[model samples]
Target: MKRSAMVLLGLVVVALGLAAKQLPGVDGGPAAPIAGPQVAVGAPNRGSESVGVELGPLVIEGRGTRTTSVVGDGGTVVLAAGYGVRTSGAAPALRLSLERRVGSGKWESTSAPVRQDEHGLHVSTPPWSASGAAPATTIAYRIASASFIDAAGVAPAVRSRSVSVVYENQAAYTGLAAQIYRDAAPYCPTTAVRIADLMGDVAGDYQPGTSLIRIDAVVGTGAMARPEIVRSVALHECSHERQWLNYDGTNEGRKRMLAAAAAQFSSYDPMGVGATGPSGPLKSDIRPIEHAADCGAMALEPRGYLGYGGSCSPTQLEAARRLLTGGRY
Candidate 1:
């Protein structure tokens, strides 16, 4: 077949596949498609996919709600429910109920008000307040439905799968840290404590011999509130951690790595102070690592604040891109 004809054939196949998926099953009649936002029910955890439940002619879909896990002042858990009727003719009157369970406790139910549309029905419960006492805890939620009643009387009940949420302290920072770690997981894998400690100045330094990142009193508590500062500093320190892991075993190896990085980003002084030439070899050796760390920070978060005027030269930016993409120190 000609190239154009083959391309046309491939398109046709994909179109057919999508059309088939939309069609009703052979055994059952036309399957009702339920659509809505994912429902999550806890702290720090996101909701899962929409669930479709068949209640005779009615097709109801329920989703869990999602919210930030941080409970600084207080937090609320949202439970959302949506549903659709599959059969034609007059739609039946329906109601949804939401229930919650924490730890090994009994289920508590709440009636959620329904809003109807041409497509389906939706309902959301009032925010369920989480106890501020515990630092972290998990909550599970499920959705149940009352029988759809029409002129013909009551129909069958509908039930949805259970979903969970996990609430915790510093949820925002922890979530951000988790994302950064995931992004750099292939190249650098460190503990949550290491990432959390990076927020403070004390645990910022990576010790080569011990393979431990020590907390040194360096960053102020107020700095933790600023995400850009935390991200920039974390990425910068993480780059150093990677370098230490790769080169700290041998002095000669470490020197060679630093020399390579320094050669690439040679425009800046290692001491971070605006100095002309370095007074000694130690300063010369240290400059590359500092430059690399800064470059790593810039590469991770280009728009983030990096202190010291929060600006990187064009050369330094280019070097950062290279280091990040090339997987180098």
Candidate 2:
């Protein structure tokens, strides 16, 4: 190899060496991975670690840089840094755990079907995903010792350094959904929502029974690649919610009232002002319930991206405003 290539190789080895130093491996005898789940308080043998683990980002090319990754609500997080086991303790056991907390809320273990405790630690592993998050909540995590470590022998640190990753709901990572829900709150107090595959380009729809707004997961993936789309979806869905509550929100009466709204909004232009192509008739936008929802979204913001390809007329918007503000449907 050329001198330059040799030098680069040397640098890579040195970097790996330095990275390994962060999580020192056990030194006494060869370490063995502890087996089985060690979370139960009364288990005969919990588990132990050798190199244990460390927090760091996971690089797709290789190992993540030697630092905990930038955590989001339900996104990337460091997995095992250096895999190993602890064979030093008489009652050999290691306790690995993941915990989380909200603002000043009690810290609670969130270990689930995933292995809570492990003995072997690898240099790099696929990131563990976090879920069930709300907006602005801090989530803390760590791997630690369940049993006492023998200080006299060479054993891994009793507890892995505690680290944290703050993430948002995977479904609403962009905060647009939450914002939409909050914006629609005054008109309809309970603006509940769900994010699902929802198939193709369909961003969202207001379901009748549950009365919950549904945002499409397929389009909203990857930190909401297109926030505007999600935002528009939310606005449209919220409009439907407002429509439902505009009526007494009783059972069959609500159905009749919503149908009446669709009929009234049917003729209203969905493309608001400055709309050009897709010429002829944006049929879907003019459909009964969808038209009403589109108009409602237009009423929210006529010029804003209300639907797939349309907005409402000024007169339609005004009517929607009055209906949304306080008047009956």
Models 1 onward score TM values of: 0.34, 0.41
lDDT of each: 0.43, 0.44
Question: How much is the lDDT of residue 63 in candidate 1?
Answer: 13
lDDT of 2: 0.44
Residue 213, candidate 2: Cα error in Å is 1.3
Which candidate wins on TM-score?
2
The runs of at least 3 residues in candidate 1 whose Cα sits more than 4 Å from the true structure, single-residue gaps closed, are 1-186, 190-192, 195-203, 214-221, 246-249, 269-286, 307-311, 324-326
Q: Report the error of model 2 at residue 61, Å.
A: 54
